[model samples]
Target: MSDIRPGGPVFAPEEVETPPKEVSKSSKPASLWTDAWRDLRRRPIFIASCCIIAVLVVMAIWPSLFSSIDPFNARTCELATARQLPSAGHPFGRDNLGCDLYARTIYGAANSLVIGISTSVFAAIIGGLLGLIAGFFGGATDTVASRITEIFFAIPSILGALLIGSTFRGSGLGIWLVVISLTLLGWPMTFRIMRAAVITAKSQDFVIAARALGAGSARIMFRHLLPNALAPVIVVATINLGGFIAAEAALSYLGVGVQPPEISWGLMIADAQRRFLEAPLPLIFPAVFLSVTVLAFIMLGDAVRDALDPKLR
Candidate 1:
């Protein structure tokens, strides 16, 4: 078409000018973690689980904030008030030993949180490191590590914990005994996951490029492979934290974990089991709290897993 105007010079087809093209600046693409965070924000399950965990963490840290009674003090108990139902003062009532059930439940949060968090952290560290080294190096190192992991993996976690707890009974190891037991049994699963992740990630283009660029073994393994491999490990760890809490409770209930002078949900349940026929409040309260806490963690893990895995989304 011609650019024709009454008072302007007519331009030839070759002389006609076209407007410059506008270059739109594209925004950076969202990363996997960024997408997951955005997804989690919209999930009701994630929000609810987080709230429950926050409250439980606070209860673990400051039991006195929730309950005024001295839960740890057995001296304050009176057999006259033993096995009483929930009253105005004690929402969960008194245990068989006349100890405040509410206060014990509040205090019990600390032990469970401690065991769960500590075991998860220790297990992840040991397993992640071993898996990284084995997967990155691959050969005899991988063979030996896999062999060791298989040996441990072959044993059921709860059974191993039961055997360890039973064997070390009366050794005065205290809560650390449970922590150690769980950590030892828990690492194999984490190791296997991390090793598989590393094996997959190391073969990716980015890692091969990094290796070609002369990155060191440690650098390639941690700087490149670890971040990619960590998502599944984190999901597993979150779920295992809940499982560890339940395992501790079972061990405690069986009289092989968290002895007297150190109150845990399991210990309280064990004490209450004898008097359950007369007053179920003692067993009911602690058991309910334990169940809720475990359920919350498991829910949180499921939400996180769903958010993090693109396939699930």
Candidate 2:
């Protein structure tokens, strides 16, 4: 179809009925968490990690669910029963102490998982709050927060844990003391991540609009900024969960963590170290469990990180 005339008004080029641009189902606006959850669902690693984590959670909650044998049962110490290799009845074999290695290994997960989750929650809350305040206010607030974070960062996480753990070793607050030590040093990394996220988020249009609407600082921070800033902190916390677990184990191995009668994988490792050649089952079982648990948390964190990051998409 030709226009009316080049010299004349030229009828609009036959108003091309460009079909209204079809709106994609995916184009509907969604919150960051909504998009992240959708992305997370599609990731195999996320699914696997979630499943493993769920199982670990169950194991942590109820060790009895996995085994009928009592962890407190003393070994017969008979030449046949003592340090027996893996058998149908005792898959993880008997330790030198005559305790069933399998039972101890399963029970150990409870302590490690509890400490990991507890420390992560404590760190995230403390760090995230400080970060929100610093990032939103900037200036002197930020300087103070950043300086404190730097001070903590300058101290190695493990060394700080060791020192604190050593100080409180004989107090009998074994697990709690270890958790406290980890929390003391753990918050800085989470704070740094959250601060960066908040800084980036605060400058966005929504925050500006919230400010324009005269929303109070607390309201804006809690309602608007916190949701956005929390994503990165969550990722950091998840990854650090594994680190905390490992740290607990390391401290336990060094004889400063969970004390006697409160079995931990690290304690099991320490107990088995003397007789590793004579009976490796005690050492191997706990080490394997610890490794799997740590790896699961790390994998979960990595998957979450990838899912949340727009650049990864």
Q: At residue 55, what lDDT does model 1 achieve?
A: 99
Model 2: runs farther than 4 Å from truth? 1-28, 73-80
lDDT of 1 at 190: 90
Estimate, for each residue in 190-216, the C-alpha lDDT of model 2 and write its tens digit. 888888999999999999999999999
RMSD of each: 3.8, 3.7
Report lDDT (CA) for all predictions: 0.89, 0.87
TM-score, prediction 1: 0.91
TM-score between candidate 2 and the true structure: 0.89
RMSD of 2: 3.7
Clash counts for the predictions, in order? 0, 0
Query: Which candidate's lDDT is highest?
Result: 1
Clashing pairs in 2: none
| Model 1 global lDDT (CA atoms, 0 to 1) | 0.89
